[model samples]
Target: MKAISYSRYGGPEVLEFGERPDPKVGPDKVLVQVRAAAVNPVDWKAQAGYLDTIFDTVFPVIPGWDVSGVIVQPGVSVTEFSVGDEVMGYVREDVLCHGTFAEYVAAPVRTLARKPRNLGFEESAALPLAGLTAYQALHRALHLRSGDTLLVHAASGAVGSMAVQIARHLGARVIGASRDEGQDRVRELGAEPVPYGDGFTARVRELAPRGVDAALDTVGGQVLKDSAALLAPDGRLASIADGEVIALGGRYYWVRPDTDDLTALAGLVEGGALTVRVAASFPLERAADAQRANMEGGLHGKVVVTVDHDH
Candidate 1:
């Protein structure tokens, strides 16, 4: 099968497209005929080798984590899924576990969930990573509830966009922060948009004279520092950016995928409680271009890589 990979981590130039041996499935694993896969920040983190400490290093790695496809075959021990079943998953591709940059990739049954019936392969592909991060950080790590006010930093980006929508669904009054241009776009997603700039915190405090009930910090530099002070005494905070910021006194969040989280997200999409937006799409051979767009980071929504299969 033809796929894109990088023997070394650097810029998009490191990505090379070529044929690789088709992955064989292990007992408990399902071979998914990958219809589409979406790019996340982590994809470039691996491509650029920035996660040396957050994760173990491996060479010639394939970095995609969010995948949507049809089950072509399931292992002998896999009873949860069968051929022709449509699924999307937050797959944890262990280093060296070739990712969804190809025509097909093998995934453990535990990582699979029935794809949202309301979505297409492209939209389904966009959900697993960014959506889960938003759901977990808001409802799980941050302890949000209805009527509480919430602030989401970088709210126009992938994870941030999802965070704003998920927070609203959970009954929180969400304020989304992004650059001046992104404010309008995020505001359309049921959030009060704030500009992320000098004195951004002051702008946010003005939104909620009392204080925000919770915050999901997707852009965690000074943004998180201010979140600590903006929280309503019991207000919670969560971040996808990995770092020990205990000095700030807010909860630190690192996304962990589970079958239950995937199921809940699936339900939300089906029920029209959550929405997936696709900013661009590229064929598998153009995986390099897709990664380039994600790396540059100016697109309005998720960047997806479409793999070919007879769906």
Candidate 2:
């Protein structure tokens, strides 16, 4: 069994591709033959040691989280799936489950959901982390409804792409804030685009007039504080990355891996209501290169690592 592992937190150089022992599944878990996995900002953040306090990672970490794979072995206690079933899910953030960067990963039955019928393995790999965060922020945290007005920042990246489409599906009139170059693609996703910069909030206000009902802020630090002033009394502001602004009269929300939510997300995709765009794919051994491209900040979708490329 081959996989990538890091003995310590550092740069992309820390990730090493080679052989490791295969994982065994517990009675309540299933072993997946990983097809593809998503490279998220947290992958790099974790590699750089930012999640040390949050994850309490033991040394020699496996960095990936979101994955789309086939069930090679089903636990005796798990009856929902069997060998050869396609599924997708993220391992819990709190757990030390060897991540999707490996040839096989074992996850609890509760975290695995059948992949969407309309999505390919690579597309399914893009959903669990980024798509779920956007779904939770808008539909769950904002209590979004049809005909409501919503503002979304960074509307062309992984979560932004999902947020724009999901917000529209939830019936909110979405205004997307993005770089001028990304404005066209943002509008194509069915959300109006506002250029991100110094007067970005004012631009959003101009479009909404009465102010927005909610905001999904993916960019934090100054970006979080900047988006806060755009909120009205009923407005909700949630950050999947940062939670510090939750006390400033806006709510902070975090996305945790849940099979229940995965089921609902699968429903949306199956019904043609939700979709994830995959921008890049790399072999498992080149995961560090995939991580580099993601951190470089030009791609509009998830950069996936294909474990079984021949498949």
Candidate 3:
């Protein structure tokens, strides 16, 4: 099948569009006909070897994790889904290869979830990783509850925007930190917008003088520190961007593929409590461009790569 891959760790220049061997289905997996895939910063980072120490890279690696597609065939042991099922997943395996940027992917059942009935493939593709990251951080890590006040750093980002909506849906009053250009977006996502950079802590404190009940740091570094200090004594803190969050007495989270969590996010989308914005899109052959677009930053939503199966 035709796909985007790189034989060595490098920048977008190393990515090539060509035919790769089709994946074999495992007993616990299904073959999905790719419809769309979303580009995350991690995709480019991993391709650049930033995550070399963490994951073993197989040469000619296919680089994508978020997918929205249809099941063409299920594994012999599969029963949770069958042929023709529309699904979305954060299809990260233990190793780097056989990813979603191809015409098809052999996805493990544990990573699959029914796509939100209300969204298109591109939008659905955008949800799994970013949505799951926000959901797990707010619900599991932070234990956010109704009436609590929450602070979100980098609130206009892919994960941060999702966090704002999920926190608000959980009934928390949200204060979001972003740049001046992103302030309106943060407000639209149901958070009171606060500017980043100097005095970020002061801005948040102005919104919640007693300190927030919890804080989610998606920007890391000084933002993580500020988030920890802004907590209301026992306030919860978690960061997806920085591992130093652990040293600051907070959990540093890395998103995982969980069917249940993805399904819950789907429910939120169908219920109109969550929405995905597609900032840009490219065809499958141009996936390198998609990665570059995501890396360029300043996007309020996701960069997606669409697969054309009609041919």
Candidate 4:
């Protein structure tokens, strides 16, 4: 099978596109013919070896986690899905290798969920990582409730955008912080937009003078500090980017694969409560280019790598 991999931890320059042996299917796993894969900042961070202490990395790693594909073979123990089922998943494991960047991936059943029928493969591919990050932060960490007020840092980015929509669906009045250029789009997603940087808390205060009931930080650094300061006395806080949030009485979360959570996201999409924004799509062979685009920044949504299995 054709795949892109890096034998050593480095930048996009180290990635190589070539033929590799197909993954062996195991019990409780399914062989998925990759239709599309989404690139996230973690993909590059992993490549650069930033997460080496956390996730076990085998050299010559296939670097991707989010995939939308069709099952070609279901493992003997897999019962929820059969061959020909359309699915999307966040396929992270304790170890890094055998990922969605290839023509196929052997995905564990715990990570797979039926893709939202309303969306295309590219859109579904973009959801698992970022969508789950946002969903888990709001629904689990923040414990967001209807009529509550929520503030999201970096609201226009991939995870932040989903946070805004999911918070709205949870019946929260959302305030999203982004650049001046992204404020309009942030507002369109049902959040009151505030520009980030100095005086950010003041801007948020102007919108919710009493302070927000919860805050989710996607951009780290002083943004988390500001979020901590602007939270209501009993407000909840969670950060995916900044571990320092834990020091400031907030929760730090790394997204985990849970098919139940993915199912909820799909239900939101099917019900017209959630939508995915795809910034660009590249062919599977151009995985490096896709990674480069993600690293370059200013993308309003996800960068997807599409596989041409028919060819």
lDDT of 3: 0.93
lDDT of 2: 0.84
In angstroms, the error of model 3 at 257 is 0.6
Task: Locate the minimum summed-lDDT window of 10 residues in model 4.
Answer: 195-204
Model 3 lDDT tens row, 1-311: 98999999899999999999999999999999999999999999999999999899889899999999999999999999989999999999999988999999999999999999999999999999999999999988899999999998889999999999999999999998999999999989989999987777887888888888998988888788888889998888889989998888888888899999999999999999999999999999999889889989999999999999887
In model 4, the clashing pairs are none
- True-vs-predicted CA distance for residue 8, candidate 1, Å: 1.9
Stretches off by above 4 angstroms in model 3 are none
Give a tens-digit lDDT track for model 2, residues 70-184: 9999988999899999999977647443777988888777777999989999999989988788888786787888988888888988888888988888788999988998898
Q: Give the C-alpha miss distance for residue 131 in model 1, angstroms.
A: 0.5
Clashes of each: 0, 0, 0, 0
Report the C-alpha lDDT of model 4 over 176-197, residue by residue, as the tens digit. 9999989998999999999976
Error of 2 at 69 (Å): 0.9
Measured with C-alpha atoms, the lDDT of residue 17 in candidate 2 is 93
In order, candidate lDDTs are: 0.83, 0.84, 0.93, 0.93
CA lDDT, candidate 4, residue 152: 90
TM-score for model 1?
Answer: 0.95
Residue range 174-202, candidate 1, lDDT tens digits: 89989988989898999999887688778
